[model samples]
Target: MPSYPGGETEKAAYDLATKGEKLVMDYLNISIFDVQEMPIDLYLFFMREAYIHGNMRTKEGREYLENCRRMEQTKPDRKKIRKKIQEQKREG
Candidate 1:
């Protein structure tokens, strides 16, 4: 699961995910379940496309984008984490 930044809660994540899912479904004429089955990269592409072309200048859109940015910032750097783990193992 993706992590949320400071001041972001699970509720906020839920709201964003549901709203984004709805937007994708309406834009693509697909169902929520269909979206659930989409690859993460494809789903993100559609989400970004929707944000760019779907008139996201409104207050809600701005908030959604802000939340998206926060969520993105919280994604762990796997390479850095792995390097740390390896260094620890070598030292021990």
Candidate 2:
């Protein structure tokens, strides 16, 4: 149900979502169905704690952090997308 502007912006959004989903699933050893059916409030809270605060303490968390770094290194377009988001925040 989520919609995004077309082209690179949309692609970037999907790419980011895929990465996040993978991180959550891998960390929890949960299926995609679990993530899909999770309540929004719980999902947000879990992700915030597991993905951010969990960093370097657990194996899964450390792997996720390393994967994130690798993603940023390989995907140069993410930098542009980030800048655009920052500009939008400033304008809003």
Candidate 3:
């Protein structure tokens, strides 16, 4: 099978760029505002690459991929998963 670029490259690049910025911020005390746009443009490049050669395993797979794409586009923040504890309180 042809090795296709994974469809999550934009998210991956975002993650990488964030890490890079974080490193610079932590170590060099540089501001993200100083070099902000290159990563964003690189993100678009990643998207285009994925669009051209994303792996579509099945129709359902394609749908799932698109859903993830939308999610990344929106940067959908997820609520923390907290476990609910059962309380045994008896009222007299």
lDDT string for model 2 (1-92, tens) is 11122312223333464665666677788997898788888777666655565566887656666666655565467888999999999999
In angstroms, how far off is 17's CA in candidate 2? 3.0
- Candidate 3 lDDT, 40-63, residue by residue in tens: 675445444444244474675576
Best by lDDT: 1
Specify the highest-TM-score model's number.
1
lDDT of 1 by residue, 1-92 (tens): 22235534335333453877877888899999999999989998887677555646677556656666667775787999999999999999
Per-candidate TM-scores read 0.43, 0.40, 0.22
- Which pairs in model 1 have colliding backbones? none
TM-score of the candidate numbered 1? 0.43
Model 2 residue runs over 4 Å out of place are 1-14, 57-92
Compared with the true structure, model 2 gives a TM-score of 0.40
Ranking by TM-score: 1, 2, 3
Cα-based lDDT for every prediction? 0.72, 0.64, 0.46
